[model samples]
Structure formats: C-alpha cells, structure tokens
Target chain A: MMGKHAQNRILAYSTPLVLIGILLVFVAAITLTGDKALGRMAAETLIRVVLVVGLWIFVGNSGVVSFGHAGYMAIGAYCSAWLTLKPQMKSLFLPDLPSWLAQAEWPVLPAAVASGLLAAFVALVSGATILRLSGIAASIATFAFLAIVNTVYSNWEGVTGATSSLVGLARYVDQWVALGWAAAAIIAANLYANSASGLALRATREDEAAASASGINMYRHRLLSLVVSGFFTGVSGALLGHSIGVLNPDSFYLGITFISLAMLVVGGIGSLSGAVVGVLSLSMMIEALVRFEQGISIGETQLALPSGAQEILIGIVMILVLILRPSGLMAGKELRMPRFAPRSPDYKTSNN
Target chain B: MTSLAQLFFDAASLGGIYAMAALGIALIFGVMNLVNFAHGEYIAFCVFALIVPSTEAVAVMFLGKAPAFLLIPVLLGLGAGAAVASEYVVFRHMRKATPVAMMISSFALGFVIQNALLAVYGGRPKAISLWPDLNTPVGVLGAQVPLLQLIVVLTTLLVVCALALLLKKTRLGLEMRAAAENFTMARLLGVRANVVITGAFALSGALAAAVALIMATQTGVADVRMGGQIMLVAFIATVIGGLGSLPGAVAAGFLIGGASVLLQAFLPLEVRPFRDAFLYTLVIACLLLRPQGLFAASSAKPRI
Candidate 1:
C-alpha cells in the first residue's frame, strides 16, 4: 500500500494519462479511417450499441439471452420508414393510410422520436406477452417475432415498398449526429441503471424471488425497461434507415441479432464500457482481419476467398470470448475517472 | 367445409418434421437449457453426409445411386458423429459454464459449421436423393399425400414411442431424467455425469440428423441455409410446447404445423403479406400469457 498522498498523486497522473491516451487513440482512429467512413461507422456502431444495450436491459437482467431484438428493430425501422417515406409512394403503394396522415411528412426530430415510440409501443405490447414467459420461451418468442416481421415486411410491400428496400429518408442521419445521439443513449441507460427503478431491474436480474418478494412488480418493471430500451432501439433503427438511405427486411436478421449479443458477451453484459469496447474492438478487429487477408495468397493460384469469411471470423471471436474471459472484456464495469478532489459544489447530475 | 383430409394430411406431415426437430432441440435444452445455437448447422451436416460421400469425390468405388434405404443408418451415424464432435470441441469445455456461455458458443459453432459448409459446398443449395419415386400417394381420405410423407409420419410415431419408452424404462434414460430433474440429487445418487451428459448430446444430435434426412426429403432442395430454418422452427416449437418436455414438443409441433398450413390457406388478401408476423404475434401471445409454455414443466430445477 502506498501513502494517502502518493495514492492521490498516482491517481491524478494515471487518470489524465489514460484519458489523454484514449482521446488521442479515438481521434487517431477517426483521422486515419477518413471522416466519411468513421462518421458512418460510428453511427452504425452507436446504433448497434443502442440495440445491444437494449438487449442487455432484458437479457443481462434476466440471465436470458434474446435472439429477437432483430424482430423489434425491424418493427421500429419499418414503422418509422413507413411513417416517413411512404407518403411520396403512398398513392402508388399503400393507398390505405388515411389521406391526411399519408400526406403528412414530419421533420427528422419528431420522426426519430416517433420511431422510438412506435418501437416501444410494440415492445410494450410484445413484452407484456414475452416478459411474462420464462427465459427460453421469451427468447424463442422474439425469434418467432423476427420471422413474423420478416414475413410481413417482405410480403406487405404496399406500405413498405415490399421486399424492395425502403429508401429516401437520408436527411435524418449523419455520422456525427448519430454519435451524439448514441452518447445521449449511453448516458440515459447509465442514469437508469443507477436509479431506484434501475435498482429494481438489477435486483430482479440478480435474484428474482427475492425481488418479487420485496414487492417489485416484475411484469411492470420489465415492461418499463423494455419500453425504454425499445425507444432507443427504434431511434437507432430509424437512423439505420436514414443512414443507408436504403432499407430492407433482411438487414436485421439473426446475423445482426446474434452478432450484437456476441458483442455484449465479449464486451461484458451490464456495462456501458463493455458495449463501446465490444463494438469498437470487434468491428475494428473484424475489419482489420478482412484487410489483413488482402495480401495472403493461397496456393498455386492466388486463392481469393468467397463471401462468409466475416461471418466465420465473428463465430471464432464469439467462441474465443466464451472460452477466454466469458463475461466479456468489461464484464459489466464502467469506464470512469478518479474523484481526486471530491465533487465540486457546482457540479450536478442533469436529468437530460 | 374445409377439406379435413387435406388439412389433416398436411398437418400430420409437417407435424412429423416439427416433432423430430423439437425432440432433438428439447433433448439438448432439457439437459442443459443450451438452446444449442448450432442446431441448424448440424442439420445441414446430416444432409451433407450423404452428399459428401456421393457428390464430392475422393474414392469413386463406394459411390453410386446411394440407395435410399441407406439414409437411416447413415443419418444416424452422421448425427451421432456431429454431436460427439461438437461435444468434444465446444460443449465439453462449457459443461459447468453459464447458460449465456453455452448460448454464445452455440452461436459461434453454428457459424463455424455453416461457413465450413459454405467453404466446401460454395454457398449454393445442394440436391440430395434419399430415395426414388416420391410421387406415390397411398389411401387416406382420398388426399394424395406423398408416400414419403406417410413414411415420415409413421417413422415419427415409432421414434417418439421408442424415445418415450427409453426415457421411462432404460437405466441410462432414467439417470438422464434424474439428472435433469435434480442435478445434485442424481449426482449424489451415483448417476455418471459424463455419460448422462454425453448421452443427452448424442440423443439430440442423432435426432437432429434423422430430422435433417427427412427434411432433405421434404424440401428436395438443400443448402447451407436449410439448417437455420429448421433450427428456428424447432426452437419455436420447443418453446411453445414448453422446453424440456418431449410430449409437449410433439403437441406444439402439431399446433404449429396446423397453424402454418392454416395461415397459408385462410389468410385474407389484405393481410396476406404479414402472415409470418401474424404467426409470430400468435407465439408472442402464447408466451406472454403462458410464460412457462403451452406445456411447461410442472416443477422448477432450483435455477440450475
């Protein structure tokens, strides 16, 4: 053990060094990747963060993993995509939504919120049904839910442009803009985690019978957390549509759902830092692996790989994460700085 | 009136498939709550078993029309082989790990198997022959049901009965159930953990392989993607019927089979597009209300 003063000094020096190093690295990565790709990648990563964290809210708490948020995200994306993009194609496709509603095209602000709300609405209804079920039941329900959504979106082309990818909501998303939104989502989840409501959610996850005995209305609490999670997931999805400026049902499949879960597992469930680390590390590592494969030649003839290498890598990573550090890189821990001089009088935690 | 003969015939056939798939999934999940994410891949592997020996070339001498009757033992061997391999590689290390660990590992293993297939088969669907002359439809209310489907249904009944008897009568089966019922008590009572656990994987894997053969016959067209679809449906069936219940799985299989057929038949033009979504909503409603399942276990296992 060090002396109190030495400990304080070490903490102060280490804190700045780590922070500066992280900042420099993040900036360097952004700079090296080119602003355009980074912006898009960051937004995509953030959207993933939202979806994964939303997953953690349910799976992390319940000790049950879900394969169905893809179902929820699809609903959210389609709902928002339909709400925002259909008016122009309305007469041509749907000819169903009331004329006035069909004619209305809201700004990005309300549209994004509407996306979250719409997703949450569905989640609330579905969660009431799913959350009431036990672990595997609830998970399988989501999987069924995804297939159901895919079936609808692919078949119900009238409002959705059918299986032909939805397009033309490009104005709502920008890389940097999405990052900001992602940050806000992270903070919101953090706040919720520390709140009384969050405490109940955590307790339920940790020990259900005790929490239930303590008078926690599990159904209500689960619905609440899911709804909140659904909200962010929806926004991320709308941003997904906006970012791509093109969307289709297949975009959110088992690939995305399980991949996100793997990220959570690798990063550490129940930790915000884990989410960031998972997305950043795996995504970059995956990209790097692909890039690395560029030079290696396979035999008499230069053997270029066909598709699915990325998927294989993901599987390998997931296996690695499970075997080594199974709880994930972070294992439900936060990234924080030392409280050197204690809280200043003026500092306050803001709700927004 | 709806053609009861046709509907029943179709439901029976589809239910046959679902029952097999659900049995495989239920066996694995019951023992471990694993939800073996790699389930579908194994199905693909079974389908590929016949294809590999016949289609992909190493030794041409053993290759021929690959008699249909040979599929049973072949698939059994393939399924058992896949199960043993997966157990050795992934599940063995994960024996005492958390459910999440198994789930992710299963997911990883799934992709690995899938990609390995892709690497070998090149991502296109493969056509495999289980037998000849699938067109004959024997009697049964005058509905022209595929004789293969009939064969499939009878085989299903036989298997389910055999499984039920095995579970209730055999020492290994009893020990397995005892272990599932109460891991600690069974262990304390001298049930060999390794044998019982490996047996569980063996049972499921063999079941999956058998299901894959039937599925390959049913679908006609085979691909790497086939396993995933079967896995998903099997998962849904087991979940709805209640995880870990063999009888429950069969019941759920029949229900889902009937639902899938009906959804295709009675759907209105306006909402025909969202039939799948509607099916999911149906499952969601069942789960939301039942939580445990349509046939959930009567007793808990102390969170083990």
Candidate 2:
C-alpha cells in the first residue's frame, strides 16, 4: 500500500503533470497535421498558457487581480528585441540604444532569460509599494503601472519604435519551444503555489486579519508571488515577440491584459489546472470559430459564421459561464488521480 | 494670462466630462460592489444611437435629426433603457457571485456591446455633425473659448445641482443613499433593494447619455472605441476619489482632468507625449500614500 505522505505528494504533483501531458498531446497532435496555421495556433495557445499561468501565480494565490503583468511582458518583449536583433537593424530602427546593448547580439535562449530577469526586477521594485495596498486598491495600482508602462513604451520612439512595429526578431519560437516554456511556467506556478510563501499569501487572501494575526507577512509573500509571476509573464512576452518576429507596444496593452485575466477568471482562478484549461479551451473555441468563419462544407452546402460573430459569441459565452459557475469552471479543485486504496484520515488536499 | 485662462477653460471642460462619467461609475459601485465595466459601452451605444447603423464614411443621422429638446430626453431614455436591460439580464443573476466574477462578466458584456457596435458600424470612425454652431469661439474671461466649452461647463454645473437636489430632496434618492451607505442594513430596514439599485443604474445611464451627446458634439466623430479612453480615465478617477463616494469621484475626476490639461500645456515638447505616463505614476503615488483613497469614507476601512 502507498503511504499517505507519498500519495499526498503524488496528488500535489499530478496537477502539473497532467497539465504538461495535455500540452504535449496538443503539440504532438498539431505536429501530425503539419499545417503552418495550426502550428501557429498551437504555439499561440501555449504562449497564453505561460501567460495565464504566470498570472495564476500571483492572482490565484494572493487573490489580488493584477492588470500589470502585460506591462512586464512589454518590458520583456522590448528587452529581448533590444538584445536579439541584428546590430545593423538596431542602429537603423532603434538608434538611441546605449553603446553596450546596441553592439551586443545574443542568442534567443539567454536573451529570453535576461528579459524575464529584467521584468522580475521591475516587478520587485513596483510591487514593493503597490503591494502595500490590499484588495481593489492594489488592483488599481497595478493597472496604473500597466498604463505607465504602455504610455512610455508607446512614446519612447528611440527605443520602442513609438507605436511602430519592431521587426527582425528571430522567429525561433515554434510549437515545441512554446510547449517547453508553457511546461516550465506550469512547473514554476505549481512549485510556487505549494511553497511556504504561497500558502502564507493564500492565508492572507482567505482572511487578512486572521493571517496577519497568525504572523504571516502578507507584503513579503505578495511581492514574492508578483516577482515569480512577472518572470514567466516576461518570458512569455519574449516568446511571443520571437514567435511572430515582430513586436509592437499596442500588442501588450489592455486587450491582452483583459483577455488573460478573463481566461484566468473563467478557468477558475484558484487552481494551476484552471489556468492551463482556460487557455486551451478558450483558444480552441476561438480557432474553431475562425475556421467556421472561413466556411465549412456539408453535403453540398457551405456554412459560414459572420466575420465578427466569434468575438460576440465568446463574450456571451463568458457571461453565461460566469452566471452558471461564479467560482469558475474548475471551482478551485485540482484534478487528481483516483485513489484505489482507502484514504488516510489525516490527509487533506490543498484547494489553492 | 490669456493663455492661462484658456488653459483653465480647457481643463474645466475636460474635467467636467470626466466628472460626469466618474459619477456614473460611482453610483453603481455605491450600491453594488461590482464595478460596471460595461458603463463605457453604454456611452458608445448612446453615441451610436444618434446615427443610423451603416458601414459608411459619413454617418446618416437617425436621432441626430431630432431637435435638442426632443433629442436629449430620447437619448437619455435610450441610455437608461440599455443600462436597465443589462442590469436585469446579466447583473441580476450575478448578485451572489464574487466581485471578480461580476467584474469579468461586466467586461464580457462590454465586449459584446462593443463588438456588436463594430459589426453594425464598420471599424472606421464616422463623422456626424451635431449642433455645429456650438463650435464657434466665444470670449470668456478674456480668453477665446469655444462656445461648446462654456456650454459643457454650464451643463455640468446644472446637472450637478439637479442631482444634488434630487439626492437631497427626493424619496427615491434617500433610499438610494441609504442603500449606498449599507445595502444589507438598508434592505433590512425596509428600503426596497431593487428600486434603489435600478434607480442608480437609470441615473448612471442618463449621465452616460449626457456625456455621449457632449462628446459627439465636440468631436463630431463617433468611433466604436471612442468611449474606452474616457472610461479608463473615469475609472481611475472613480477609484482615486474613493470607490463608493459620489462627491469624491467627481472631485478626483476634475483633479485628474486638470492635471492632465496642465501637464499637456506645460510639459516640454519632447516629453509632452509621455504626459499620460507621468499622470499614471502620480496616480500610483497617490494610492501608495492613501490606499483607502484621498476621500475614503470611514466605513471603507476594515476592522481588524
């Protein structure tokens, strides 16, 4: 018979493993098709998985909705563009880069890591002050951070091309690469969620007064989560820039911010599984809708959805889902393997 | 000095618009914990209501053809109708959900509205002249201000006074105030929850309609995304003013608008485009200093 502690450990890890398995299956299935568009869709979905999972690290644990992660993504994307682009292209488009960065051209892997680190550094500094405020105040402060980042990026012509697209990024990120990052993000999120700080932050989320009274340092835990969350979000941004081979400030604004948040919330913001599931489900629905818009043949008839019906339908579906399941589709429960042995009386599953 | 006077009028006019939008958000937030992200869509909807649905360069005026006396009330009613319908259809069922869920739902609702508008009217912004005579320059306090600026300021003052009277003197207003203060307690004390909530939505929607009319007149162009920028500014204003405080929201709205105008006027030419970045940074600092907000009610504080 398996020991309870071993069983509990298996349960704790099963969530991420299952999520990674789902991603692997998705990648393999798409690869079999060998279709470029399908490959791009799969890669994009995995990138979202990384983003929403990064979001889950902070929002799911701290219960503070951050509208600022996309700002970190912008920082990461720009930093990667600054690092990876050819020196000649940089000089022509982004002439004002400091001498060292202007001359330097790094491989995609190191640049991506460096981008994530830069984003984490920024998150640490910003979250230091912003995380002090609890509840909606913190949420708004994060939003302000996003707005500040967006404005500066949009207008910083010398560096960010000032609303113009920054091209020449190495298109190195494919389905397999995105899958690796998504798996890494899921692992990071899972490890963070099960960490001591994660538990402490969640305690604060559940009952701030009680948690504080019990000696949980809410600020420290929240900042830690934000930093971790920012890192992966930044990496995802780098991947997105590399995948598309172009970066624009507008791409990392309120639209992505809300959509990612929507995915997190819709998938059940409480569990790691929810983040992954939300991205896959929503992405698949969108792809299917796009395909439908492109028209489908059935028995000598062609059927097509209106061009913009997808967005309206998705919005309506989101509303319907919320109305039916307010807590989200996962409802804060992690998917665990079935236990054949009698359960240990002392063992309890962590809900967060 | 004349430039300063001109700046002042410009600031006040812009501030007045934000104040109105912020008030609309604050009203619903006062009664329900939900932040109505769909409020912006209501503004867009009202603006589009003035024009017939067509994907054309020039918008054909539908309600825009009506005289001011008839047009204003009809638009306000349409705005109110939209808000009430949303509240009844979407939000009513979400009463028991968490604030985050409700917020997402509201966002989804706004998305639906925006995309629906996008489908009906193509992506391009359409020009529709409304009260073009109001655009003529008029000297005010030794400054050449657009007549619409003066009108906007005056209309804002009139609306504030009328709202003040209604809130202070009307029975429905008292119930709303009570509900806003403490919904559960007010409900327990026999104030009808539905009536107060519905009244707030109606008032908020009418305010949005008023903003729509002013924006349409001032810009003479109606884009599907036009309301989004103002809505974001107004949302920031609502929060900085203290989420549930009506007067605070208005005050913050004007303050932000004034700051934005001043920053635009005074910032170096090279840095003027980055003015919004500076503005939002100040907003973060403001929140850091006073997380409960500059004008938070005592009840806003949690009893630990």
Candidate 3:
C-alpha cells in the first residue's frame, strides 16, 4: 500500500486529471453530435472556461475580487488584432498606428501568444501599483483601471476605430483551438494553485498579519498571480475575438466582467475545480434556458418560455445558490475519484 | 470669465448628482460591509417606474402625468420600496456570507433588475419630456445657466443639510451611525441591526430616486443604461472619499465632477475625447498617494 503522504499527493494531483477528462468528454460529445450550432456553443463555453480559469488563478488564490481582468482581456484582443490583421486592414481602419504596426502581420498562434505576453506585461506594471491596495480599496482601484482602459479604447478613434466593431479578422478559433487554450489554462491554474507563491498568497488571504510575520511578501505574490492570471485572460480574449471574427470594446466591458465573476463565484472561488465546474454548470444552464426560450419541441408541440426569462432565471439561481451555499457549489474543494472503499467521504467545505 | 463661470455651473450641477449617488452608496457600505452594486439599478428602476411597463418605442407616462408634488414622493417611494425589498429578499439572508459573496449577490440582483427592465422596456432609449420649463436657460453671474442646473445644486444642498440633521438629531440616525462605526459594539449597546440596516436602505433608495428625477428632467431620456455611468463614478467617489465617511464621499464626488469638467474644457480637440482616461489616471495617482483615501476616518487606518 502507498504511504499516507503519497496517497495525499495523488489526491492533490487528481484535479487536473479530472478536469482534462471533463474537457475530453465535452469534445467527444460535440464531435459525436456533429451539430454546427452545438459546436459553436461548445466553443463559446470553452472560451469562457479559459477566461474564468484565468480569473481563478488570481482571485481564487489571493481571495481578492478583481473587476479589472476584463481590461487585460481587452488589451490582449486589441493587441492580437494589431498583429494578426492584414496590414491593409490596419492601415485602413487603425490609421493612427505607428508605421511598423500599421504594416505588421503575423501568424495566428504567435499573435495570440504575443497578446498574452502584452497583457502580462501590462499587468506587471499596473499590479506593482494596484497590489499596494488591500481589501475593498484594491477592488475599486482595479475597477478604475477597467474604466480607464474602456474610456481610452472607446474614444481613441484613430487607433481603435473608436466604439465601432473592428472586423475582417480570420475566424481561426474553433472548438478545438478554444479547447486547447482552456486545457492549458486549467493546467496552468492547477499548477499555480499548488505552487509556493500560490500558497503564500493564500496564506495572506487567510491572515495578512500572520503571513507577513512569516516573511511572505504579500505584494510580490499578489503581483505574480495577477500577471499569470492576466496572461490566460488575454489568451481567452484573443480566442473570443477570433471566434466572433470581430472585436468591440463594449463586449469586453461590464457585461463580461460581472458574468465572469459570477461563474467564478458560483463554482467555488477558492479552488481550480470550482472555477471549472462553475463555468460548466452555469454555461449549461444558460444554454438550456436559451434553448427553451427558442421554443423546444416536446412531442411535436412547441413550447417556449419568455425571451428574457433566461437572464432572470440565472440571476435567481445564482442568488439562491449563494443563500443556500455561500461558499459556492463546489465549496472550494477539488474533484477526486471515488475511494475504493468509501468510509463516509469527508472533504473540507470552506477555505477558512 | 464667462466661460469659467459656465464651467463652474456645469461642474457643480454634475457634482451634485454624483454626490447624491455617492452618499447613497456610502450609507449602505457604512452600515453593512457590502458595497451595494445594485444601487445603480435602483436609479434605473425608479426612472422606469415613471412610465408604464411596455415594449413600445414611445413610452406612455404612468407617473409623469401626476403633479410634481405628488410625482416626486411617489417616485421616491418606489425607489425605497425596491431597495428595502431587495435587502429583505437577498441581503437579509446573506448576513453570514463573506463580503465577496455578498458583493457578487448584489451584482446578481442588479443583473436581474436590469434584465427585467430590458424585457419590459425593450433595448431602446426612450425620450420623456418631463418639466420642459426647467430646460430654459437663466442668466447667472454673467453666464447662461439652465434652470435645472440651479435646481440640482439647490436640491443637493437641501438634501445634504437634511441628511446631516437626520444623522445628528434623529434616534434612527444615531443608531445607524453607531452601527456604521462598529456593528458589534453598537449591537452590544442595544442597537437593533435590522431596523438600522432597513433605514439605511430606505434612505439610500430615496436618494437614488432623487437622482433619477433630476437625471430624467435634465437629460429628457429614460434609458436603462443611463444610471450605469453615474453609479460607477459614485462608487469611485465613495472609495476616494474614504470608506464609511459620508462627508468625504460627497467631497470626492464633487472633486471628480470638477476635474472631469476641467479636463473637457482644457484638453485640445484630439485629446478631449479621452477625458475619462485622464480622469481615471488622476484617480490612480490619488489612490497611490493616499490609499487610505483623501479623507480617511480614524477607523479606516490599517490595523496591525
């Protein structure tokens, strides 16, 4: 029999394995169905998984609610457009770009990676200043950062095309591409959640004074997590832009911010499994509600709920979940295989 | 000199609205640890209440037909009722949850309210001409000022004075203040947490209604998105003014409004469009300089 420590290590590493299994099953299911619309839906859900998992990398570990990750996503999406769009498209639409950027063109993968790097660079610069703030003040400062990014993007007409959707990009991100990035994000988040810096960040999240006394630099760990988080968030944004083949500053604003946060909180803001499960469960619910709104057929009789009931129902569901299980659906616990001989399963329910 | 005077009037008018909103947010945050993100929806809901719920392009006024005296109170009541009901329905049950959880729930409530309005009103921005006479410009100190601008300034002043009185003299206000200062200590001293929290929500809601009335009258539009911008600025103001500090919140609100106006007036045409960016950059600078806020209450100091 394996020793207790080895058994614990196996259990700890089971999360990513379980997550990979879920992704593979989802991919297989989509392939088996061979429905174009279902493929598109799966692509969107996978992209959301990327974004939410990226969010979990920071918020889950640090226990800080960031209203700013969307800003980084915007930066990444625009950067990707700048790199991957045809030189003619850039010169024609984004006329204010410098000569080099106006004439630049790159492959899709390189552009996406560059976009993530650009977002991480921005995150590093901003996090140095922003991470100084703690608690609600830090959250508000991040929000201010979002507002700044949005205002600049919306009004910089020459550079960004100013509030209008930038189009004509190749729609290169399909289900498989999005799934690849989503899996990468899941693995990265899982690895970081078990890393030394991640542990230190969590310690600060639990008790700042104690963490500091123990020589943990709260600011440094926080900034590190934020940079990592920003990188994946940026990639997700690139995938979204490519999926839609258009980029709009409005799409990366308040609507996505709240929804992404909702998914993270609903799943379990403290664990990798929570982030994945939250996105999966809520995305399915939203899809189901959307289908019902589109008049689902039952025994040849068409039935449809109200057009906007999906949004209302989701809100109600989220609220009910919070009231009933404030820690979230997963309650900050990771996924693991069933024991060979179950002796009344026990798992930690809350991070604290 | 005339342009300067005009700028001042514009700043003060905008600032007044922001101050009211900041006060509303600060009140809730003071009493409860939660920063009520749904306060914006309260303003939206109040404006929508003025018209009959329908999907038509042109909105028929349900409350707009009422006399001003009657209309104001009714709108205020609607805002208060919605706010209090939300607190009871959602927040009351979330007392034991973490602040982050509560904050997300508030966001969910806002989402529900916004989508409900969207369903009933459709996604169109409707124009409602309420009190057209208020739109007329009046000469003030060599500058042409709209009557609505003057009214907004005066109303803000009156509301502030009334709020000060309530906080200082009323028993309910005293309990709220005590609760805001320290909830556990206040409860130990016989303060009823529920009553104080309900009172704060009611006041906050009424203030939202007030801002809604002024906004509807000034802009002559009742779009679902109208309140979002102001709410965001107010939230920023609430933080920059220092948490749990009402006067600080009001002052910060006015300062932001003033800075925004100044930037608009002075920036060259090319840069004028990025006024918000510059304003937010200034906000980041302010936060870096004083993370505790410009007017930090003693309690706001970091505890070892």
The number of the candidate with the highest TM-score is 2
Clashing pairs in 2: none
Residues A97-177 of candidate 1 have per-residue lDDT tens digits of 677768867777687888888888988887777677656666677677678767876776566666776666645565556
Error of 2 at A44 (Å): 0.3
Error of 1 at B131 (Å): 2.0
Model 2 residue A18 CA deviation in Å: 1.2
Highest DockQ among the candidates is held by which one?
Answer: 2
Better of 2 and 3 by TM-score: 2
Model 3 interface RMSD, one decimal: 0.9
Error of 1 at A7 (Å): 16
How does residue A64 of candidate 3 score in lDDT? 85
Q: In candidate 1, how many clashes are counted?
A: 5
Candidate 2: chain B TM-score equals 0.98
List, residue by residue over B105-145, the lDDT tens digit for candidate 3. Answer: 99999999999999989989998888989989999998899
Q: Where does candidate 3 chain A have its weakest 10-residue lDDT segment?
A: A343-352
lDDT of residue B70 for candidate 3: 100
| Whole-model alpha-carbon lDDT for candidate 1 | 0.73
Off by over 4 Å in 2: A1-6, A344-352
Q: Candidate order by DockQ, highest to lowest?
A: 2, 3, 1
Write model 1 residue lDDT over B153-211, tens digit each, in one string: 79889999999899999998998788767667789999998888789888888888888
Least accurate 10 contiguous residues by lDDT in model 1 chain A: A12-21
